[model samples]
Target: MLALAGLLGLGGTVAVQAADTPAATFTVRQLTPETALRAVQAALTHCRGLGYQVSAVVVDRAGLPQALLRDRLAGAHTPDVATRKAWTAVSVKMSSAGFAAETQAGKPMSGLRGDPRFMAAGGGLPIEAGGSLLGAIGVSGAPGGDADEACAAKGLQAIADDIEF
Candidate 1:
């Protein structure tokens, strides 16, 4: 019985074990450069349609900028603003406008404002599909945060059909 148990790897330090086999494999969806560019274009067009002259930024799941589009008349700082918004959205996995509201003065999350990379503003929205986060989009140079958020929403709509969740 002892020999059988040992051979079966049921006991002892020199016990045998079952051979390893590859188990589960995962397929994570990523935002391609073309998709990122398409999102940027859609955001820019949406903002322009609203006479916003905004800058749009698309960031990957890691909060890295994948594409950016700035209107000719947009302020020089618009790109930075847009990029920051996209980063905030992907990093936190939520809308920048909501984050802003939650981090306002007197809120428990106010400390988040201390982070330079964290922006408590609107215009940032996370892009999610099939329950997986793809990336984010942001718009800046609009007259207000709401306007910027609207443009960002339009950007996400451009690729809505391509994602599943």
Candidate 2:
């Protein structure tokens, strides 16, 4: 029971009045809008430095958008795509690139693509620290999925230290 409390403490541990009692509630970590905005900015800047116009989106752990940015020259579709990618990352708890690979045509998981909200692109990455998922970031319109993924990685790297707590 003591060991269980330690393991359950991501944001905080659940209260266990007795060994046989169930926890009534649990705490969870969440990303702030400021942090989410910073991630999107870093991703967008990285794409711009590479001469690729793009859009970036950050979604909370619950798959809700916290921040979003679209470059002036980015295609209108980029914003929606970026949001979908971020939402998908948080929803699936994995990088969109990995999801794309797993759900490729003829793959057993390909049917997941049928969901309108699931964008199996490479620009999405889950934001995690200390084994807890805080949010996710996504980038789009960077020439290719690989480039978009790289930009999203930069976004995550930018805030790695801040999210550790």
Candidate 3:
């Protein structure tokens, strides 16, 4: 009798707990390896066409490099610069150009330059789809930060058609 009572109570408690469980969902969009490769290639092509030896890097949402491409003469350290730019972009979700501008202005967020991973340059841009940030792209080894940014923008443009806003 006592064993039966305990079993019934346990069953009731389990049912009550299940009924009280919350129904929450989490979803996100991410880039494929093929997409990352294409982005890097597009950036490389754009920079090459402009007579610039540049490096491009694509990073995932966590700021991890997915792909990196460097021109034959992009310099030995170009890849590292590109990866850092990508990491900075994804870490803050702000174009490195925009971040540089803000940091230069010295306002509410003046300490942006203190972070080692943060770069106040123009070659980093966040990649987003449907208001969700998917990753980032960065270019380096161009004549200037603005020029590097142009290459990074090309990378993002290459994949814009297939992704949402």
TM-score of candidate 2 versus the correct structure, residues matched by position: 0.86
TM-score of 1: 0.83
lDDT leader? 2
Q: Kindly indicate the candidate among 1 and 3 with the higher lDDT.
A: 1
* Tens digit of per-residue lDDT, candidate 2, span 1-165: 777767777566664498788788988998888998999999999999999999999998888899999999999999999989988898889899889999999999899999999998799999999999888999999988899999999999999889997
lDDT score, candidate 2, position 149: 94
- TM-scores of the candidates in the order shown: 0.83, 0.86, 0.83
Residue 116 CA error for candidate 2 (Å)?
1.1
User: How well is each residue in 41-148 modelled by candidate 3, as lDDT tens digits?
Assistant: 999999999999999999999999999988999999889888888888898788888888887755767687888888788899999988899999999999989999
After TM-score superposition, what is the CA distance of residue 106 in candidate 3 from its true location, in Å? 3.2
C-alpha lDDT score of every prediction, in listed order: 0.89, 0.91, 0.89
Considering summed lDDT, which 10 consecutive residues are worst modelled in model 2? 7-16
Clashes of 1: 2
Cα error, residue 130 of model 3, in Å, equals 1.0
